[model samples]
Target: MSLLSKADEAKLKGQLQDAVISCTERCLYSSAKWAAELLNSFPETDDDGSETDVDSAMSDPPPPQTPTPSSKDPIEARLEARETQKYLLAKTFFDCREFDRCAAIFLPDSLPKTSFLVTPSPASKSKPHGKSKIKLGTPTKPALSAAVVKGLSQKALFLSLYAKYIAGERRMNEDSEMILGPQDGITTNKELPGISAILEEWFSGLANSGRKPQGWLEYLYGLVLAKGKNEKQALEYFIQSVNCCPYNWGAWQELSTLFSTIEELHQVTPQLPQNIMGFVFQIYASQELYQSANQVHNSLAQILDIFPGSAFLQTQRALLYYHSKAYEDAEQIFSELLVANPHRIDAMDCYSNVLYVLENRPKLAFLAQLAMTTDKFRPETCCVVGNYYSSKSEHEKAVIYFRRALTLDRTFLSAWTLMGHEFIEMKNTHAAIESYRRAVDVNRKDYRAWYGLGQAYEVLEMHSYAIFYYQRAAALRPYDPKMWHALGACFGKVGKVANGIRAYKRALVAGSFYDNNVGSSFGSGEVSGLGGGVLDPEVLFNIALLYERVNNMGECAAYMELVLAQEEGPDYDESVGDMAGGVGVTPTTSKARLWLAKWEYMRGMYQRSMELANELCQDGVEVEDAKALIRDIRARIESQKGDSSVA
Candidate 1:
């Protein structure tokens, strides 16, 4: 090579490094590829007789030489040294996990000043003419070489493909964060299969070239497959990654997550770096493996020295505490995080949850409103606002927020269910039914939705439909007394006496009629308005009527007595009870007591019936009927005495 050529090559290599650095810092993939083109302008000649010595190439550079007598030129060796260094620097950045930096060098738009060695635009190339034309004072630019054009194109293609693949892996975290509603519209156009195919092609090329993929390459390929939902295939590469480099924390984390049990991960846990233990802890905490979660957290805590001033770590610790139901600890940690960065939306979201669990609605609402003002589009903020309105019994306002939340994320099952509840509170049975059905459609496992559906149907007097929904709800929550009670009432309405009686008995045995263990995404807390009379007096009354239908007067009388006793007790507070859905429970009044008196007479308990009738008359209820019954009984008694005397 000539001195002029060697000098030009060295300058071009330096420009390539600058472009790479600039593009990488900005994460400009396409521009970085263009930068890579400048470095790849010249081909490196490999000796077929010997293996390529990558280490020697990276460590040593040819010294500047004087003129030599041999055919081998000193300038050529200098040119080769610049080429090797340029290539190695790219690889070094990639291996250091500075991918954006490495990628920037390969992008097309990253060039600060165009180099003569880079591929030139076809429009910029001037065609030869038979006659020379007069030129101005401008300097002439050199024409691009065919080899340089082809090499740049080849390098650019590979780099662009690699950048696209990296973008795909990045989308995994983006998709996760989107579902979490921390930000909006972070989704990219790259599909998983397309990216995976590109990665496989690149990896295959490396392997075919007698080179193994780097640890990060394998780890990123595994991420693509994992994101593509090919976990089984991903696992192989993930294992290969850690095998290639045990310090690959990402590989370790992915492997740890795939392990079904905490015991399965124990083998690698001790080998995990302290910084990576946070990811392992997240896995355990998310899966509710509390024992393993606690162990991992304690180990991480020791490593972080209790995270004295790191708000991020402190917030994570608080969430773990919240998951473990150490609400007070969670509250304190969240408070500290908020104090450090009071405008932190996530901290506010979590702090609101802590307040909700403590039933501090005012504070919960305050935090929720603040969070909403910060990020109105976030589903958690919408939910917090909705929940506050619900607590205040401003159900219409609550529904608006709940619907807004659902609009943000339709798959938010809790929002759907809560919306149904708001409709029910408004007594809009049809709308409630539709909302509850949507909840069930979103998640059939949500028992609250099923119960809401049942209640809505029951209100509309669609007894058969009510029975169907109640039965479904009961199946999911077999121990829920309210479900069984509602089922029994529906059966009675549809004239299924035997089924009604069976369901009523089940209701009685199911313990409390109210479900206090209401679960929510934020956390579990007490539910209100579902409790009034724990043992519904109306259910007993329905069972009594069902027995009376079969002339089982003894059982009927027994149940009627239970109803009366309940009505008279403090446990059966009438003020809180709502019998809006034709729940078959009537307020205990003169009419209810009179029905007991009539049933006693029908059972042939004449003397007992007479006593009850007399008491009813004295209480100034059904006086005419009680008096007429007494007169008839007295006449019958006199007739019987006369007959006995004759005999």
Candidate 2:
């Protein structure tokens, strides 16, 4: 057997580890299992620590000459020792969702310690105590202790801590309702007391060490810091996590949820490392920001240029279109992805969402059936089924599937939001509000939940509270005209004319942007003046009404003119003897015309006023108001004629 050089051995192990990580990231568990088997093929090194043992298995069976200590890599030896440990098995268990089994593998004295760390001696029968480290030949079981867990690789340490955390959560879930009652959200729970002890004792002195924390260790520490509400420290550790593991999407996703506002995101942007991880993190941040579609699209284009084949990136692009309410484009992209990989259920939930919005019943039903056939247990599958039911207006059945999704994953944000939508449909306002609140708790960036909350409050006639929620939704999704329109409506409901006017102006701007081209990307422009579009006749009319409220007659008259110019509705066909058979004029158009007539009469433009009033009456719409206005104009014209004759 020929002994491999230390550098060669380390490089080989790194290659194997990278393969496993890549497979796992793609959720290719079977491939990961095969890779793990290949890893296991490399024989475990004995406590004596020799490259000969591992090399012997891979190469010739003949004995090899021992290399001198000076030629050995310390990292190589550490890597060998870790192979002898059960972390690999623990990791496998972690992937299988066997949290308790995974935790057990890392439990105290669980795995056999290799000869390098432990040696049996008849004289050293006693256990080592504090104040002194174990000497070379101490006879102790292969047990880990409070003072002994140091210098672990980030993955190793994170695995141990995270396993315990998951196990603790699973244990709590058995009787979660009894253990933690209603006020506590499912996404949050009390600290696992033992976790604190493990951090303080098992990871003793780690915080005090001079070494910078590795990514996963920093992630673990950040969890503790975040739980403590020590946001400053948590932010620092999370920043370190991304810096150290630039490709760690999970860490970036976690970091993305830490902030609730754009102001907070900007405050921390300078502190983030500006590498690919930070670049991707900014993209994640934008999902919540709801910036202009063009701006978001451009940023995504830069990343997609680097990784054109990434399904995750493509799904995000699809999501951008969905958020912009460009359902057709989003649906096309999602359909293409599914056609390429029919069994892939990754984002089918979102695809179903597009179908639901389009009311493509057949497509939605087909997706739900296919998703169920692929893997009914997945939360995405459940969501697709839920969406199918939702599209059918089967609110009760839809809620059940959405509930199942949440049961599978408490942090399933889409399930929570969708469930709230169903509750709203069923007129269960309180339940809808609660579900939306939980969605917000899971991810503050969920503008859907905020918008839902506003809708729920509005249904309850809580205008002030609805305003607060709508404002939050508007702030996050500034480019969404629906949010601006909502804010305008709510502001007007509360008698805030000036505020309502400003909000309507913004609504006009956003609506114009959406109407011009749903594909265009741009930030929400400031709005002192009104924007024109078919998207905003209602908004224009609202603005004109608000102006009238404040008695700004000139602005009111101008906006009213714009409203009439925009409405362009087909007048009711009173000529058809049966009114119901006529092409109906929308009430909005009728009211706008009435307002113009009143304005014209006040300006002594009696001819124009009578023309409009007569048009309204002849259309068989708003006849009573039109007749009254016509009478007043007649009286005024007669008075003017009488005065003229006197003159």
Candidate 3:
């Protein structure tokens, strides 16, 4: 008959409770006003007419007038009592912040009824005439007046929406999302529930009502969308949240993460939590916004005062200092942390890295020894020792440390990867491959291990295996140029000329991209000439040969010239022997020049070929081959001129 009546029927039928609450909320501006109106609306009929009792309306307890056992009408009083009880129950649930229970209470019949709410069928009674009598108790249900319904409406809707937002946030983590940088690898996926659909329903309901959701609701939705990789939607929600409540720190945190510049973060809120400040620094560092990162790091002391004894915050602060070239500050903080807790192997490793960068060899050695004293069998401690020796060009000692690390913990992924690197340095391809295999077994997503495998297989001339390993590495780190180059080389070895050409092209693009993109202090670039993931000019020379094999003479000559030009560049020297991550390798410049000379002679550029050959000989790189090429070119030129000249 009425909207309130319909809502009651819907509740009994276990449907439209959310809709009912939403509609009720639209009618009431605030819960307190609704409560006062609800209590005042109850009227009593006197001798002349109906009158409201102000005292009864003002107080939550029923009127002072007592209805005796033989009172005139009790139905209204019973309804009033029932409504008051239900309203109190709803209020209790809201007070406890158990919004889900409130939603469930309002929509109790929506799902299976609990045993307590179900009427039990009475036990059958046997009679003398073989007849059984059966009985069933009527199930009791709570009833609420329109006043009580309207009073609880706002809270019900708020709780329902809040619960849905929380559910969606939790489910979003199940989707495709990555936590850290490329090195952290991909996250595992979980089976999602119906949270996304619930969130959508909540939004749809709010939109239909033509009302903006609460500030916290917007924040939660933003976090959910962000976890789901819907950055644009997440950004919109985060902005809306901040616009609604500038003091919402959670919204500011999410907004800070989605934004690119410090200005965007400041727009969210100038005052941030220590953890949020740390996040800001990391974002700036990642985008190579060093100036901004340093600015934020400078405020670390003040932020730390608010969040005392947070090791994570302190460690991030130290890393920021390191990136800003405040190495002394970084080193000091790291030293303090390590001294406070000597078993902090990570701190020891980091401090050692900072010392290495500063070229403070004595301090680095002392840190390494301190690490050893803390835990000789710790994987990270051993790694620190190994990396130190490796840096000093002491391959044998590095191998011993790496081996000791593995012996202590075979499943240590870093040790396995680095040990393979050591083996590669020692020219033991077989041992390197085995170590890499173990690393892969420990963590298949480790790109470094895959790259090591690619190097070992390439050395053994197992081109197919090399291709597989390099492909894995490339999949994990698509930005790594060396992986693509190695893949191209393998393809060329397997006689897949077209594929080789494509891979080489990708390698060039990726290499240029890497050169332009700066990295964080903790990036792979920190340790130069140590990892296989580095630029290699030899890739250009190899690509040139691949072009030659395919008979693309123009492309072959163009690539050869590119190689020579690149070698002449200052940055080319840094990439000289990085290919295959091996030791004792000569620069590829000489070989590339010699190949270019031969290519020129084949293309009938005798004079140009002669110049390159003579230059190579004078430079004393591949001297014998260059001399032979020069003699042959001279002979060919004489014959062409009909001089018939000979030595």
Per-model root-mean-square deviation over C-alphas? 18.1, 12.0, 19.0
The CA root-mean-square deviation of candidate 1, after full C-alpha superposition on the true structure, stands at: 18.1
What lDDT does model 3 reach?
A: 0.57
Clashes of each: 14, 3, 0
Best by TM-score: 2
Q: Quantify all predictions' global Cα lDDT against the true fold.
A: 0.59, 0.70, 0.57
TM-score of each: 0.45, 0.75, 0.45
Worst 10 contiguous positions by lDDT, candidate 2: 520-529
Q: How close is candidate 2 to the true structure, as a TM-score?
A: 0.75
Q: How well is each residue in 281-388 modelled by candidate 3, as lDDT tens digits? A: 434333322232444655555445433444545676776565444677788888777766566675455566576656667777877888888788787798788778
Q: Candidate 3: how many backbone clashes?
A: 0
Greater lDDT among 1 and 3 belongs to 1
Which lDDT tens digits does candidate 2 get at residues 497-528? 89999998887776655533333111122222
lDDT of 1 by residue, 1-647 (tens): 12225565455455455545534532344445544543443434353224656677644644323222111334324433444545456556665656556555543322324454566567546653323332332222223333332333222333444554554445534564533244423344354455455456556565444333334456667877765557777777876765544333445556644554345456545544333333434443343333324555765465344224445456667766664446777788787666666666544545665676677787777777777777888776787788788777789898888878776766566677777877888888877787788677655656678888988888889989889998987776555566677788889889898999999888776535333232333232222112334445666777888998988988987888777565444443368663332223334434556677676666666777778678778778777887877776667667878999999
Identify the leading candidate in terms of lDDT.
Answer: 2
